[model samples]
Target: MRDNAFWIILQRLRTPLIVIVVTYAIAILGMVLIPGLDDKGNVYHLSFFDAFYFISYTASTIGFGETPYDFTYPQRLWVVVCIYLTAIGWFYTISAVISIISDKTLKKEMIKGRFVRQVQNFKSDFIIVLGYNRVNSEIIKRIRKANIDVVLVDHNADIINLFQLEESSMGVPVMVEDALLTSTLKDAGVNSPYCNAVISHFYKEEKNLRITILIRFLNPKVKVITRATLHDTIIAISDTDIAKVENPFEIFAKRFEIALTAPHILILENWIYKNADLADKASYLPEGRYIICGYGRLGKLIKEKLDKHGMDYIIIDENNVGTDEMIKNETFICANADDRDVLLKAGIESAVVLVAGTQNDIDNMSLFITAKKLNPDLYVISRVNTMKEISIFEKSDINWLFMIEKILINKTSLQISQPLKHSFLKRVLYKDEEWGTSLVNLLKAQLGDNPQLLHLTINEEKAFAIYHVLKANKPIGLNILLKSLANWQNYHKAIPLFLKRNGDEFLLPSNELLEIGDEILFACDAESREEIELIASNIYDLHYVQTGEEKRNWLLSKVISLL
Candidate 1:
């Protein structure tokens, strides 16, 4: 508790403490100066102890009879002087104490002290979040939902207080300081071993980049996830240890492309995410002229993807200034999209797909509602960046609502925490059609209608492993590995998804050969995942597998040979 603010308060009290000490000293000295008078006006010697007792009683206003003798006129005058001097000293001291209690700086420091104690005592592994903006708020919600601990830091005092009020029960320790400061990062325990991830979701791109550099230097093992809106900023941290850089517009364009091409997979994805209703699966992007409202980064990305796919589309923006020549050629009308006149001029009445990619949520909603009114069958895709006006999008029955913050957080978290699983999903479930079907079949067979993505890792709780074969290791052919795995998984339901040899990936090929330096990915519901690990690690012999013989443990065999 004795931090800088504690010292400051103590410094302020120095004056009052000095006042009290000096006042008592002077009063005692005065009492001893004038000697006490005895009977018949004779002078009596006054000891220091007797003078102390007299001054103590006088200062406290509990005056009693003199112990040694009665007081004379001069001594009585000194006693009166001591009483007022001590009273003035105490009054000043009490005021100072009250002033310190009500001081804003002192209260803030006290809060910080409590936060520091709580963080130091926190037992669970936590993620350090750098900002407390709208995006970070959604991220915080999801992090808490996963029952993960969070340490929050922000520069705004009011926002911190608001968060403390809202999430007080979660016991989230918050630090109100500039996140770019290394001292602030250290105070948040970013360098601690338990701090697995640092997510820099600051509003400014520069702060995120600086935090990325700082975290990589401070603790290279701790993964960093950041968001960048500028192209140059994204490119700057691409080769660094910053594992994830979330760009909302880029992600939106990719998802948009999926909606246009493989709408079924997009529907399945939304169902898995639980972001939209699955019953509207048939109402994917309809085939007709598309209307794109806004000419900003988000709008441009969607249009570029559409142009690459040879789709017809029209763009409507408020101004033609600073517009790219190619984009200007596709601009249907250089007018306000919210105006009904511009909507009519852009053929919104017959448009099948309408995308509201504007920065303003209200404007996006207005354009969306206008398009729906013009063409009720219009496939509406709207962007919502903030939580303030989400009800408008919800009540309008829009086909797709792209919450930018939610998407960014999901993308970043996937890359940081479950990179392999995300890689598998992004590569197979979203891209390769045959592999996507194979995965869907796997999930359907295992989970039926409640298909959800799961990872199989070789932690204590789960029996799973990912390993790369080395040249020095024995080369166990794929046929032998599969036969042994199949026999072992009879009780454990384990299956290998793919094998990466060199840079080529082979998915579930029964005849594929295993070689040195091949990486494998596996998934299993039971403890059979360990069987594959043993098979890949050269624990089982092909002869023992071909016949019904017990296989020697490779670890024990190596130990025996060493002996």
Candidate 2:
């Protein structure tokens, strides 16, 4: 598809076709005024000016004017021929006009040409968005909000053009071409001192990884943010030229993290959509001595959050990158997270959390096991793709594991709770399909096959608290549990909803406090907890304390009283 050249010529011909029509329009009206056609076969004499007028009039042939002359048979034949030619040409011109106005081809081709030409005019200080999607648009908007110049790229030319036109006022240039192509990449100004890192696609994690690698090869100094669909891509792109969004698997972890830490950020859009405002809180930092084992997409986001909060952390990956730049506070250990020595070297014992969010599924599992071995207490948070992997990890002693399948399931089910036509959720969730095919919504709809009802809340410990319902359990308890939250929360601040329940019945949502079956995802601020507790009725005593010796034991002990 990339090599196809057939359409290029057709695209270039649009301008010439327009010129032909404009010239023909002027000539058509005059042709009909000539004294040419006679009643018989012989020719009727007419002046050159009259001939021209007649031809022009004939060409325009609106039937608005009287005949200029009675013509012989041959002259009449000539007039008929001229009328036919004029009418056919006018229709042809109309068809061409419609094609130009309606078809995407001409516009896209022109935009691409303009983008290519605009590349040479580019100076430094530009950001590159290497895929097209709502996420990309949001990312661009964020970058632009910061007043940074960005050049957007994607396979879809029309989308890029739309961005260009919409952002024309902003003066951001967009290039409609593949980010992987060297020529196109060059047009993106990847190496110019002004060029920042390249942003990868949201869903096309694999492609993002490849593009980042290419970008790195093109210009190692340029910072690149890549994406990977699974955990292993993190490991693969660890030392490559880009940071990771951490694909679908890690995305679930990040989303769940946002839910636990900042549910307000998670809410809205009928599902969890990443908003810049909450991104900082959602990042994994704040408490010092944290370790991000894989600095891919998820890790990058986490890293940024940490930075924004002025927290300390280290990045560990097989590929050595940005090690020299990190220095004391921001350490980069070029080794596997699975290594016991590496874990210890990264202060695993003292580290608050270990994000095992590599793009590879197997790597995440292995990383979790190895991390567990090194620091049994480390909050080894990881991501998984398949539903089957959930039980294995859950039973494997991982206290803070977030599975993508369940998240996708939870989100999708929430969206399609009712039938397609009868669903308010579907209307909101699929309003524009603008978020792209959210796997969360799709998996939820598929619950009829393997029904599971899961909800989430936060607890005092700050570690995610979860409960599940198997097929054996009745669905009625969920709503009752939510209703009785006040009963459960007299002793606890965080309320846990059914974090993950495996059953066919739909779960009830409550404005109550924590309940017995509640899985609480904690928020960072007391205010967030206070807000959550307002609706929660029955809250049970689930203790949450900082690790080892508390920083301010007495201060934390009086959390509820202080509230």
Candidate 3:
């Protein structure tokens, strides 16, 4: 209630406050000028305040009445110059006043500034995100990993307002406004030399177009990016020469399909972020009876990786579940995943891993309890639909990974505190192209600004090394390829950390020396991208990454002998 009242008061104060400040500045200038104007041979004819009032009337161009002082030729000339400048200044000030009056956002933000103290000293190469969402915020943290500054802007100030009150960070700044407005954008330093802009849809299509139009008018030179929802809209947005524009829903579709068909990918991504070294090692050698509850798309992929690696796991499904060959060849439990007795008969007590991957939150939750009771030492992993449920799973001693909604809570919180990041990099990173390109932009800015972020294609896996581009004016690198890890996804994190060519055989990165054209897949934030790229490309000729080929050969032989 107090916050609401505070915001209301702020909204009520914005226009009047601006008017008072401008009026006072003009009044002070008028007094100083009028006193100088009435100086006639050391005998002042009019008091400075009186002359000041007369000029105020003149600037308003009120008909000459009650003149404070008689004007000589020099004094009249000064009045003429004052008339033009003061008139122009008045028009500009009034126009600005009108802009503020028509906008309610000015006050909402004034209330926020009281708490978050937005823009607590901005720096170069900052990302300014125009809309707040999960993917957008994830982009902020990914960029922040490179140690760059971030800021967020939104018309719904309550979200950011609440965020500021909770987290008292000095670097992240949140502002409330439609960034399209010049006053708000300028406040955010949109036209400043050091800033970049990322403009996302404001919960509607028209707003995206409206914001785009407004940004162009306010700053034609500023780099603006947007994510188009309609695939048809992609061409139109791109035609505008926007720094970057994508069909957001297209990426959402891809992500949906990935989860629906190949959930291991997300699982791989999670694992990569958590364990950097897991990329170089094999997912095999661990022996256990893994229990998979849901035989849905996610469950199927988990089964495939388990089978490919020669590890044994039990598949449990209700009536008519396709253990087709499974009922004959492999150990299987045919019953509900949550039925306590079904899991008990399946030897849940001895299971090493239990995956509660069903879509129904209740079912997944129920399975969690049964699995926990069966095997206290069992590693439980579940996929959640919302962040709120994360708290529920938090106590279950289970590793939690969510679907698309997963990135929201944390990303939303991060962007709320970092308004400076509403611009270029944040938008580019989330407005997707593909995984490889996404990985490249995750790299940091190097010695200069306006560096190239890749839009790439990789046909085969081979040697990766440094190369020169941009007509030799710029040098570039590819850093980390992050994977999601959790549940049975421990298999999908990464194939190998880095790969390079050694004579005729492709080898893993080694400590000896780097060679040109050697490729590496590293998982990192922005800062390490270039250095890793140079190392992979052998730009500096440092053989830091060793090829794991020799070890893989021995490991492969052992696997062959086992088979």
Candidate 4:
């Protein structure tokens, strides 16, 4: 692509360059052949060098007066012709240059060339985001906060331009091109070892699937994170190795179920994702008759979960055409859910839960407000279609809100930026409610509400001090990392949430002996995380934390002995 840009410039300006060269050659030749007279009236011809130099300034309209003598009649006549010839040639060349500069194809190639260079020169890890929108913009912001670079590719020039206009301290390189093309991905550096992951969250499942297959073939090691809402699409995407598929409907349904059966588990998961504070108490969903508005994909998924729990519910959608026979016959009302008559038909007055699951934000908000007017005690859950109206929904004080954009952003960012933490959260979903509650209590007790999740590997790169000590056959336990440097007797406000060694997993393994290749995930505050890093990388700090006394270096030890 970089070479393409260079070639494009040459190709576009080829004729203009030829014209300029020929014009200069003709002008210089005329000057050398024509006769001129010096002050002494000696007839002489200008040298090739002087002719070339005179034409150089004359063609540019600099008009450094005539050089080295006065011209004879024929010489003056030829000079006039040369002046206009060069001026016309220069004008044509300048116009051609301007035309090429304004050409869209050339501009795209230049931008792409610059983008390719940026990706090639990238030193740190980066993720390539396929499309851009409010969701992706938010994802990029969060990813940047973690000090990771993000490259964006979008087909819409307007969206790309809008994003570029935003006030971002760290500029994100963007390419305005079709993301579905293999060439686009290649230019984005899908094969680069530094390219950590590729994110494709297109609305079309087929596009995402194609991207996953392309990335797999191009670089099987690069993790692919994408979105797919359908079961078949999800299964197809899952077949590719290291592909993290996010189904917003499925995720929301599972979360809704957790809120019903295990509120604490939902709370814990939210805290881990930084969606909620650990100090915030869990609000359990009431189990009773429910009213679900809209019968779209999201609505149907919510209905499936409700049926799984064997809960009584009614679905009210404006259009019930092409819906399943069972749904049409069973507690489904064919009317606008926001209408008072529809609410009464759906038994909203007696329903304990009302889900405004429409794809439209305004309709969902209307349904919730109307339902709440009838039944003030209704536990309302609404689906927010766009982020623009989020403030309106928040101001309405809906009990539980589901924003598909937010769900996708959180899930995709978590999986890409923090794979280990992503894995831990996935395992957390399968654990029993009792286990979740205990973990939540533990996190709150030790790391407080906003503890940062840190993943550490005992290797030469990540933990030099600890790796060397383990290599030298020195025994170090997980407890050593939790000890404070100030006082080894007191532990830091951190906990070992998970440990991995030799394909075995241990949860909350305290006082366990550390190995050279052990991977550990800790939940701790910022201060504790820094302390842990110091202990892992600095030998003296590790020694101080391990032993009560600070270990001195060779020079310090000799000076102390002499003293």
What clash count goes with each model?
0, 81, 58, 0
Which residue runs of candidate 1 sit more than 4 Å off their true CA positions?
Answer: 31-77, 122-124, 180-183, 191-193, 213-222, 237-240, 271-284, 320-332, 339-345, 412-430, 452-457, 460-563
Residue pairs with colliding backbones in model 4 are none
Evaluated against the true structure, the overall lDDT of model 2 is: 0.53
**What are the per-model C-alpha RMSD values against the true structure?**
7.0, 20.4, 17.4, 2.8
Off by over 4 Å in 4: 35-44, 62-70, 321-330, 447-452, 486-490, 501-504
Error of 2 at 357 (Å): 7.5
Cα lDDT of model 1 overall? 0.71
Predicted candidate 4: what Cα RMSD to the true structure? 2.8
Q: What does candidate 3 score on TM?
A: 0.39
Ranking by TM-score: 4, 1, 3, 2
Per-residue lDDT for 31 in model 1?
80
- lDDT-better candidate, 1 vs 4: 4
Give the per-residue lDDT of model 2 (tens digit) for 105-218: 666666666665565466646667776665565556655664667777777757866776665326666766667788788766776777756666545567767776787788
**After aligning candidate 1 to the native by TM-score, how far in Å is the CA of 445 from where it should be?**
3.9
Cα displacement (angstroms), candidate 2, residue 478, comes to: 62
Which one wins on TM-score?
4
lDDT (C-alpha, whole model) for all candidates: 0.71, 0.53, 0.52, 0.87
Give each model a TM-score: 0.74, 0.36, 0.39, 0.91
lDDT of 4 by residue, 388-433 (tens): 9999988987988899999998988877777677777887887767
Q: Give the alpha carbon lDDT tens digit for every residue of 1-563 in model 1.
A: 34767787888899999998899889888887787777877877677788788778867778787667777888878877888899898889999999999998888787777777777786778889887877677677767766778899999989887887775327788989888998888888887878878888776788888888888788888878888878899987666755578788888888787766665566445644555433433334677788888878788788788888888889888764325665567555677889988888888888888888788998998888778788888888888977678777788788788887778767766554455545554665456334444555664565343333334332322321212322335444555444544453333344566566666766654545555445555555334444545544443433445445766778899999999
